[model samples]
Target: MSHLLELFRFCPVCGSEKFVENNKQSKRCNSCGFINYINPKAAVVAIITNSEGDILVCKRAKDPARGTLDMPGGFTDLNETAEEAVIREVKEETGLTVTATRYLFSLPNTYKYSGLNVPTMDLFFECDVQEISNLTARDDVAEAWFMPRKEIDPEHFGLASIRKGISRIVGK
Candidate 1:
């Protein structure tokens, strides 16, 4: 929030230069009384598993965690539901079409991108994929593969939320 306060010097609503911190999560414009609330973004993650119980993981191609393992998912787009986002992200990153999604859990995350720490609520789902045999890495993923649960290491995942998610699954 300190960074956000530093970044936003002008009021977005009135174009006033008197924007000031109103609270921990918001800023207020002295000229127009407009309050800007900083909210966490919505993201989705798919817990894809093969029939043998191996978990699907992707190698991140870009930074903030490049070259590390991640689940197949990303931020939800405008006007899109979390379920739709999960399915779309899975297809975009792993070339696997999600036929169904079952909500599993959620975790708070801070994604550092372009020098900004973006807060996010990561929604997790167990997804059933179609044509699982046709897996190919795409988009921000450099590689995608399934690994046995026993061989999974949470420490190998770059993101904190992903590591926690992996721990939860491996502990199960």
Candidate 2:
């Protein structure tokens, strides 16, 4: 969780290691009046299914899961709503524009990556693509294609959040 060190740290005000948990779910420095809060991170994922029920999957080009098939999604930026983040991430990775049809579900997941514990709150949405064409992969994506639900392999997926999202859709 060293990566978390940048986000979580000793309160500058109080030198005491002992801290109190605040009602708002934050740690208050005991010595000095400093508060440390764990901010919730938003990750938006797209469950893109066509009229035939085929879903879009992308091969990840970066670590966590390089060369693995997963849904197109990413972290939501500040000031951007979850819906907007889903649409933007899908377009950025798959070159397809989609309309968020409905909210699917949210999942809390954690994993160790690069020696850091990454905790994420994933917000998923079922979306409809406006058009289907030959998708050119972006920097973070190696390739994109529509795969049948039965053909997905959970073991080759990038993250648990993605695997769980697909499981909810396919009832696996």
Extract clashing residue pairs from model 1. none
Report the C-alpha displacement of residue 124, candidate 2, in angstroms: 0.9
TM-score of each model, paired residue for residue: 0.96, 0.81
Candidate 1 per-residue lDDT, tens place, 1-172, comes to 2645557889987899999989877899999999998799999999999999999999999998999999999999999999999999998998899999999999999999777788899999999988798899999999999999999999999999999988998894
Could you tell me which residue pairs clash in candidate 2?
Answer: 14-32
What lDDT does the true structure give each of the candidates? 0.92, 0.78
lDDT of 2 by residue, 44-151 (tens): 888887778888888998877788888888888989999999989988988888854588899886655575566789998998888887466885899888888898
